[model samples]
Target: MNESKHNTQFLGLLGQSSTFISAFSVAQVCLTWYVFSFTGSAVAVGLVAILETLAALLVSLPVGTLVDRLNKGMLLAVSGVAGFAVFLILSFNVLFFSFDMAAVLMLAVVWGASREITRSAGLSALPDVVTSGTIAKSNGIYRALRSSLESISNALAGGLIVALGVLSGFLFSAGAYLASALFAAFILLPFLKSKTATHPSGQEKKPSMLEDLKEGFRWLVARKGFFLLTVSATFFNFFMDMIITYYVIYVAVGINATSLVYGLILSALAAGDVSGSLIGGRLNLLKYSGKINVVLFGGIPGLCILAMGIVPGIYTAILFTFIVGLCFGISVNVWLTTAHNIVPPNMRGRYFAIDGALSSISPVAIAAGAAVIALYGIMVDFIISGILMVLFTFVFASMRSLWKLDGRVHKERPANEAT
Candidate 1:
């Protein structure tokens, strides 16, 4: 009965999360499209995306701390409701009031903050919503399915905006949030929903926010293996995002591919990723140990990068991009699975917040990458980047810290000690 209840709650949580991400993706596209259509400025479009993200990152620490201090399930619902309110206000501002860029930007910030709340709360709540045995699968399905949904949502966004109008677009996103809130409120469990943050054992006073944040930092640093994994994760996110940021220029200018061909290439990448995520979710990727699995998947992407740069035709480029996506996608899901299982429930929100903060600075890498492309050419950039990635990634298979994360080393230790 307990398993059945957890499964039921997981389904509801999935519904709530899917709608949240799908709506945000589509709404962002619509919002950016409207700004571009009216202003005819690429900078304005970029601003919309950047500001929203910036707002979220600015609030990440506080949001994560708040998530830890509250009932995570209820917080998720609150996030949904808050998102709904933001979209509705934006809709009214655009539809009735005069359209002001400042107003739009302000609301975007609000939406981003609300979205971050959901993110932190959801990550913290996920472990409790499903059995430990399904943690890997749940994490994979949650992310991969959301990615697939976002892709589809963005694909149809332009058509929807054209046919339905931008006001309708805002309302549509608002409706998604409303639906999400309903699912969260009615179907999601309130398990661990209260402020249960523990201080030092036998202490009466709760920690201050700074103390809580400091403790989260302490928690990560105290575990050397996990700290290494966190650094590895940050490096992967930085490098991978840099690749994505520059990939378009390579296709559009370097190869001079048509928009249709480019679209197909992206589709292929997405397909490979979704498929690989499903595969990773189902298998015990640690069978060869996490170290070997990480090295294999991580290094394969480097080879794919080399192939993508060296391959002559658009078709060949697409194939290698697909391979890169597949390998990287698997590595990502495996790490999420492993991390989800390892993080203490009380620390998940703060841990992920710190992780996210590390990722937020990744845009700096694009500047370095851009300099390389400008001076060395995109092909040279790819070659150098791929070689470095391979040299470093082909580097992880023997990291005993990873082996111990899953107890492979611990099991051997017991046997050796017994002998």
Candidate 2:
């Protein structure tokens, strides 16, 4: 196919994938609320979060290898199908049988695994879809669209949960996953057929899974600055997860807000994300990425969180959270764009998987955060998290090598043009 046609098909597939992801994101919000409401225990919510992260951790390496060896389109489809099946079962059980925490935890495992696979496939497939020059723009647009949809979905889901109850939310999520699966199977698979076939024939020797994983890790280790950046991000993620795990609880239980109010606060965050992503998509990241990262990642978010904690009212908290999301949206675009430009296309899957696993230490963080909340109270936990976040960012930014990452990365052959 011609380049324009190929790009069109790729964008179309990505759009569909984003739509499915937005729905899944909404489902996650609903599930979080449901779990907390049903159990009324911060520890229970923390356990659910931990279990989900553990599932992702267990499959990270294998999923990375599979993303490289298998058809990415098929991987995406399988992920959606798995999600659909699990949620459908959950919905049925919720409607017909008792509310089983065990079943919910089991489904969390499956859902988490599927989410990791889908994310890996998408990251690995990006280079095949767009030119190196447009990676940042494409990623930004994708994130913006996803955030916009998520905002709407979250707003709607809050009302849905209140109006129709939690079971209906699960049913809607099941349908969303089914639609995602259908889109991947029918739309994306056709375009990827040729790409998949280009791999070695059945008779050709393929590296062992262990070797493939080793190669991925080696590639990552060779990039010292990027590796360190990932480490810093992992730390950042650790604290961020703690805050997220208890955010709903803090707003609903601590601050005494309704479910609808909580959803609106979340929606405000997503709205800010949408705005930042749109702006990020259009900026010349090659020129100003460093400044953007220093401000957005290193400075703004921590301040926002700190302000949110100190502020007295829900509206003030929402405003601060919105600012945090805006910074996060821009920072994430810069980070992903830089990574995509530097990493070899063939190794993106493994790179992303390893990075994900490192960042996915949320389970441990959540457990810790839960304990802290139980002892120190939510307000104190937020203050500590914010302070640590600021300290980590300062330490990371003090590294001269990290500040020069964008310049050094531009010197390399871009990933999309690698092979």
lDDT of every model, 2 decimals: 0.69, 0.78
Q: Give the range of the ten consecutive residues with the poorest summed lDDT in model 2.
A: 410-419
RMSD of each: 5.0, 3.3
- Candidate 2 has an lDDT of 0.78
Q: Which ten residues in a row have the lowest lDDT in candidate 1?
A: 410-419
Q: Please, what are the lDDT tens digits per residue for candidate 2 over residues 1-419?
A: 33423576566566667757766866787888888888888998888888988998889889988877777878888988898898789888877997778988998999888889988888777667777666677777778888888888888788888899878878888888888787778877777666552345675877888998988777776666677777777888887777877888878866888888878888888889988887776686655555566558746777777767776468887898889889888877887787777776667788889999887898888988899899988877777788888887778777765655662245654323311
Model 1 segments more than 4 A misplaced = 1-6, 31-46, 85-105, 158-171, 189-202, 243-269, 287-298, 302-318, 366-388, 391-419
Tens digits of per-residue lDDT for model 1, 260-297: 45445655666677777877777777444356345645
Candidate 2: residue 403 Cα off by (Å): 1.6
What lDDT is reached at residue 51 by model 1?
Answer: 62
Per-candidate TM-scores read: 0.78, 0.93
